[model samples]
Target: MSTYKAPLADIRFALYDVLGAEALFARLGFADASRDIVDAVLDEGARFNETVLAPLNRIGDEVGCVYDKTSGDVTTPPGFKQAYAQYVDGGWAGLTSPIEFGGQGMPHAAGVPLKEMIDAANLAWGNFPLLSHGATEALLHHGEAWQQEVFLKALVDGRWTGTMCLTEPHCGTDLGLLKTRATPNADGSHAVNGTKIFITAGEHDFTDNIVHLVLARLPDAPAGSKGISLFIVPKFKVGKDGVVGERNGVRCGAIEHKMGIHGSATCVINFDDAQGWLIGEPNKGLAAMFTMMNTARLAVGLQGLGLADRAYQNALRYARERLQGRSLSGPKQPDKPADPIIVHPDVRRMLLTQKALTEGGRLLGYHAATLVDVVGHGADEQERQQADALLGFVTPIVKACLTEWGVECTYHALQCFGGHGYIAEHGMEQLARDARITTLYEGTTGIQALDLMGRKVMQLQGAGLRVFLGMIEAFCKEQEGNEALHEFVAPLRAKAGEWQQLTISIGQRAVANADEVGAAAYDYLFYSGYVALAYWWARSVAAAETSSQSDAFKAAKRETARFYFARILPRTQAHAAAIGSGAASLMSMDVTHFGG
Candidate 1:
């Protein structure tokens, strides 16, 4: 069986040493987020997830969720409820929420490490509360005062869980095709009639009332996505007095039999004239929903990072123990029948790839999380705006790359196990299965790539890219004199220059032919990601050199940085070449002849 232990040391190293998150929290007026307090939180979170949630991972996958056909109820896997209760009791649900709404008011970055621990410990189980973060963001940003009083407190305090109900049977990516309708009622509320599919935590026994942030079209609203409106539709209706009342006109029609994350209940939620209140202005629902979606996109990125770390952990453990062919040099362990598989060069390659990606991804995800704090509570308006731009730009990269890499790392880890990885006993296959969903959900890699290229870079005039490139230039200049970082600095500087030029080239081509954007988008996103990670890996080495980390730990950082630069950073070349190839090859084939 596989086991998981939170990489607390590395997590702290990333947060405090690499990102300097503690100082950022201090500057942002997060009084309760001092290093001491954050440390305590991390330690406790590690204990809770490692002990309570980690043990239930296999069981969660094995048993999955149970649905009652007659009652339209869903029961999560065993120990899930108990674990969630502990989680709520420990005040984890509101760790990063506003204090005014019964939360701890910690910086969003402070919560990321704990979130990573939860995901790594048990991903399916972690899905239960995952949507709540997005829901909380939607209500906080768009919901009215009354709505906040009635719904936000429950969600913040963990008395109830929340979900984002957007996708329907007819619509997954395109929200404009939605058929859900909402009609204003006599009591100042609306009657929401819709069927939303693939709603995570849509129906579960963890909470008595499930708050769903539903997207539906108001009557007389314009057509397409503009007609949409965000609504607060709870499973159990709540009154002004904050009392949970009778059941609303919502039920779980069914749950999906997914490829993985079986412990999570993905429900087909049907709302039959459910009493609902509008979250924001009518026909402005997509903007409000995006408030949730953006938050979710970041969280989903962490999910990928977490799963990859877990897979790497288990694979590393297995490789150290599993004896295989002798080392190429000779039998170092002559007493044994053969040396461990880890002695093989191929195995080391796979393990290092996982390490490089996960550790580098931690910085990428954590820095984005820090931007959440900065955008919300920056020292000045310009600071907040820049952070917002950079965050918007990085969100897609984090979501797509980390997730795609999650699938990659899991595959590598499973490969390390050889045939044993295929079997269920080693628990490697489950990780592989769970990692698959992160890429497909939230947004697929293709969608993210398009968003990064067409929307962020093209539409926004590369505001975020400008900010990121500036940082790279400054870092490169600062490190130019340091001989230790000379190798990484020059290459990173060159890549940064190339990245900027690549963006310009794509934009120039896109001006003439729109298809150029689509053709170059996927490759462009990945190229950006590889270069972005290269910067982080180099900074990681610089950070380690100055920190008080043990000599061995510091050496590991240098070696990993070396490996990443030499072996992994070269991936940018292929992506850049693909982008240079342009839209001709992609658009040349006739559509009708493609099926053959």
Candidate 2:
């Protein structure tokens, strides 16, 4: 059996049962997005992912991507262009784009789950289109009127693709040291020059043109990140009549040999005075670029969750079918040559861990996606602001925690397959390798932790934290008598309380000691992530209790929740202790200490 299925029931449960996605859609006046429409969309998305995309998984990994310097073009694995053509023909590329831009205008919540399914089926293939979505988001928010009119339609229709060019050899996380430059031309345009490395989908054959949203410093601008500006640099320049024009100065210097996601092209692009148009106001490029980064970060978290889900599905299938030693209680399958591995307690433990985390991650991702919709279309300004603030707080947590656990979950899933897990045939190893990049790209886990603690929490004066805690507290109050769910909620509340106190303590300490914040940041972010997942699980359990208690559905929910609290939730204690210990230990370690 393949590791790809619709997971339709679970998706429905999360969307309608737990997250109230249906009501939110109706309340937001998205009248066309009814339950039937949503289900149909999901079903079609699943079918495409399972059938059209899943076949490319192994082939893409094996063939990877090839760059021909002489031709200045990157070739995708066999059948990728055909698959992408089908994807575009079906209008999947514009599923959530604005209606004015020739898109379906569906809510992000609807589109994101579809994205997860595709990513789970084949992460490497999914990344190209995923990056395009990020670029589209940046353009929609920050692009000028003419720029939007000229580019948004083609982008939304998938006639063109997009990429974000920010990272350089000297600057990855530290954009302040970025050396790319944009010099003003006689006309309103600018001449972009410099090289950008680690650019995903930087150059590809998937579309007619590639729109690059590049970050560069203008001449006579101030030093550091403050002087940077965003520009639209198309691979093939667009003329006044919207026709493809001459090739711009940009060229792919080389492609990197990476650990994973080899199917997605990561190129070193050299921009030698390329014609470019500035995006947004001068010196506000960071803000515009962040529009893409924040979206990409969440998408990366979804990538992590998708990989975990796929790994778990594959592992579960293997466990149930692979015969091994007899059951602990004696031969229930005595008639057979051997019992299946699923009969063993340890195998069950690993499977349960994967299920709990993947399901929990899905719930969290869908919840966050709903918040994006709320922030975009909510009735009240305060509601939108609150959603924005809370989302900002959880963004780093979602990215860091999900990606980290995704790698762990995939590893455990591989372990379930024994020797076969390591083999490329089963595709388990590929899942783990592909998952590794989710943590590294978007932002490393350490960078995410710093963003959470230093920017989201400390700089915002804990406004986001208070909003999140208040919501959790209100939920606890509402469900005080919910015995079915209180078992999950009570522990969650206590853990969340500990987390809040820990945050307060750390925040206080960091004021007097900058090192203290850095030291505790990662641990604090992780602890908070656990707390967040626990809250999601609790809500899921409560929703399950209120639903018609079909034995299979209710039993799975309860079992998954039990597995989470018993095995997964306990790790937060370690994170809390580590955070409480402060930065002194980390700072005091001498260089010689590592030599031993």
Model 2 ranges off by over 4 Å: none
Q: Per-residue lDDT for 205-229 in model 2, tens only?
A: 8987899989999888799889999
Candidate 1 lDDT at 457 equals 97
lDDT of 1 at 134: 89
TM-score of every prediction relative to native = 0.99, 0.98
Clashing pairs in 2: none
- Find the candidate with the highest TM-score and give its number: 1
When summed lDDT is taken over every stretch of 10 residues in candidate 2, the lowest stretch is 1-10
Q: In model 1, which range of ten residues has the least summed lDDT?
A: 236-245
Q: What global local distance difference test value does model 1 have?
A: 0.94
TM-score, cand. 1 vs. native: 0.99
